[model samples]
Target chain A: MRQLIVFTLAILVSTTFKVYSQEIRIVNYDQLDKLVSSTKDSVVVVNFWATTCKPCLEELPYFAEAGKVNKNEPVKFLFVSMDFTSKKEKAAEVFSKYNLPGKCVLLSENPNNWINKFNPQWGGDIPYTFLQDKKGNRTHYPKTFATSEELINLIKKELIKQ
Target chain B: MKHLLAILFLFIVSISIAQTTGYKPGDKAIDFSLKNIDGKNVSLKNYNDAKGYIVVFTCNHCPYAKAYESRIEELNQKYASKGYPVIAINPNDPVAYPEDSYENMQKNAAEKHFTFPYLLDETQNVAKTYGALKTPHVYILKKVNNELIVKYVGAIDDNTESAKDVKKKYAENALNELLQDKTVKEPETKAIGCGIKWKKN
Candidate 1:
């Protein structure tokens, strides 16, 4: 009876760990550039996120699910985390804790540089997403988070624009 | 031509209203007299002939502000020599974010070797005047034909958390455009940081 209980507990712990460890990865600037360049033909969805941002965490699963649904399509999803260098470990832990998916990269530059590059008027607010079509028309959807329907609609719109 | 005229008209109107209300592009910034770390006084009017001014709302405690401390210093160093001096202001209510207290501000400025005046807006009137809603919020102003026309308002950069994946430099771009007498492509951006810790109303 004791052996059975121990075996059940071990299985549950291992299962939880295995399920959660597949979510977050930290890539450098070169990796990010490569990702962006590689997805030139597809509608690139880049979502800016941070661990401290509650809405970012709340809305992450929807993006993972969206990535799954569009796996066969010419759409690529990139989750660019704005977590500070000091909190990389914490961000990684949270990623495992939340089981986030899609290609995740930790942003390593100052906020002032990219806010305007993305949209000269962006204020470095996150969970902001920048969606672009093949025609080079880019739409910056800077919001707290998007519902699954909202995400789907945006993806569909980008695909249509292509 | 019509668009130019409309912009000119809007610019004049925005300037007139900014004195008593919201800050918009082309507005002549109002003068401010705020106490410095050593109880010294500082004012925008003192630099009446300055080519431009970079008024940055920052504090001692915010992680976002801390992330750009060196960059802010670098900006001040780069521009102050070119006549665009930076004025760092602490607008957080001490009661709320205790780390923003005057004492801590002094310590942080000293520790960071800040070259600019770390002005303390005791009444926070200067912050309210500028509608500065967050730490690290920046306002770049230029003396266009002797009128203090605002050239830029927003974040200091794109990536505050990390400096590796940054794509554009907003403050620098605004400064360069102003120097060349060209319109700033991006004038204003949303200010993101720890929300202003105003004295609870």
Candidate 2:
């Protein structure tokens, strides 16, 4: 009886871990747009990154650290992986490796259709960051963050505006 | 006074953001003389019989560029005879990415069997003037009355991951339309790609 109970517990743990690791959602452009624009009473930090981009890999940890530091604040982090839909598993693996504090989604659609919708000024560069305050004022940073402090500071500034 | 200063700062930021300073469709593109992998300077004027050029700002390192390498080669094969030869330019700073160095570019082209002239934008001035911000950025120019008119600007296609999955061949469609003497319906497009590495001042 005890052996069966132990086996059941192990299965539960493994299944939960599997589910958590595969939690990276694959979203189309419209779904991503809704997710970003529909956030209520919170500052949204949407980071565009790819597994193949070197600078993106280098700076992801900073965003993850920033997310942890601002856990108490009303800021939400959304990692938008620009990886090909075929490489969704690799993207999920990278996302899990960071132990990121918020949701990670693979944006599976032609960027040509929606890049201007996010920011016409953005020339489709990865490591791009889009920040929105509670009132919907948006800021675009088309470069990598040097540290978690830089990200946290930006979030703080946005929070105070509300 | 603080509020006034803030407003002034915002205005400056907006101005910087809005400054595009790049070529748009119908704009006449300037010809450039850049060093090709063959150690010879290649100028658009050299191609007297050509109808136009497919100026691709690509590099050795970017995966998005690599993914479309074969397609770019195919474009050169399919259109070079028809007069629109692909002129690939590596625009990244080698100091930031050693993989984008001229030596590696030669190796990449050799390995990929690229028929196009892979040039190095050594000063990066050409890329800046054309307003190319990312690797794999493309500007299709049409020769009209001795001037190179910018016809299309953007990605090679709608899909970057799989060539077989591509539904809209953006660059090829523009080329076809140009060949048929029709106005390109979609003049511009955008795609997520590796940002071109610029030299630090």
Candidate 3:
């Protein structure tokens, strides 16, 4: 009976770990659009980043920190990875390494098809961030967030807006 | 006082916006004299026999640039003889990414067997002048009466994943139309790429 209980516990732990690591969903632009636009009561913070982008990697911790700081707020953080579908495993590793809060998805579509849909003015630069308030007002940041404070302040400002 | 502050804010915003705006299609591209990997300075004016140029702003570090590397080589192979030789430039600040340094760029070009002139935009002036925001960004220019007229600006194709699966060859289409002396249908396109690492302000 003791052996069986220990075996069961080990299997449960392994499965849980596997699930946690595999949590990143591979999504196309339509599904991503649904995820971003469906939240009516929360401000959606979407960060487009890639594992290969140096500045993007540097700024990941800031987003992670901001997500934790704003956990109770009506804010949803979505990390939309712009990595190739083949590099999903690498992206997943980074996702788990950061232990990032909120949902993480790998956008598998070629960006040219949907870049204009997100923002016509965006010149397809990575580390780009999109913030959509509850009222559907959108803000686009085409550069890196230098610090967690900067990211958190942006979220706070959006939360209090009408 | 509030009215004065508001006007000042508007003025600052306008200045910043103007600074960010870069060359559009049909604008005359400025020629640059940047150092080539061969230790010689190359400029658009030196290629007098060329009909146009496929100026690519790429780097050694970005995966997006790596993915398009072979395709860029192929573009030179196909078009160099047709008078549109590829002039690849490394515009990223080496301080941010060591792989983009001049020495590494030279090594990368040699290792990859790059046939085209791979130049270094040391001060990043050429990149800023052209308004290149990211690596693998292309500016296809056509020489018109000794002036480099920007014809098409954008990605190499519609697909970044696999060249075989590409549906629209954006750059190729523009090149074909230009070669035939016809107007380019798509003047501008946008693709996700690594942002050019600018020098610290």
Report the error of model 1 at residue A63, Å: 21
DockQ of 3: 0.72
Off by over 4 Å in 1: A1-82, A85-88, A91-162, B1-21
Interface RMSD of each: 4.3, 0.7, 1.1
Put down candidate 1 lDDT per residue, A1-162, tens digits, no spaces: 999999999999999987555435566556665667666778888887777655577788878777777878888777787777678777777765654445567876544444445465454545678787765567887675447778878888989872
Supply candidate 3's per-residue lDDT for A4: 100
Q: Model 2 chain A: which ten-residue window has the lowest total lDDT?
A: A18-27
lDDT of 1 at B123: 89
TM-score preference between candidates 1 and 2, better one? 2
List the candidate 2 regions with Cα displacement exceeding 4 Å.
A1-10, B1-21
Q: How many clashes would you count in candidate 3?
A: 0
**Candidate 2 pairs with clashing backbones:** none
How well docked is model 1, in DockQ terms?
Answer: 0.19
TM-scores, one per candidate: 0.59, 0.90, 0.91
The worst-scoring run of ten residues by lDDT in candidate 3 chain B lies at B14-23
* Alpha-carbon deviation at B36 in model 2, angstroms: 0.8
Q: How should the candidates be ordered by lDDT, best one leading? A: 3, 2, 1
Q: DockQ of every model listed?
A: 0.19, 0.76, 0.72
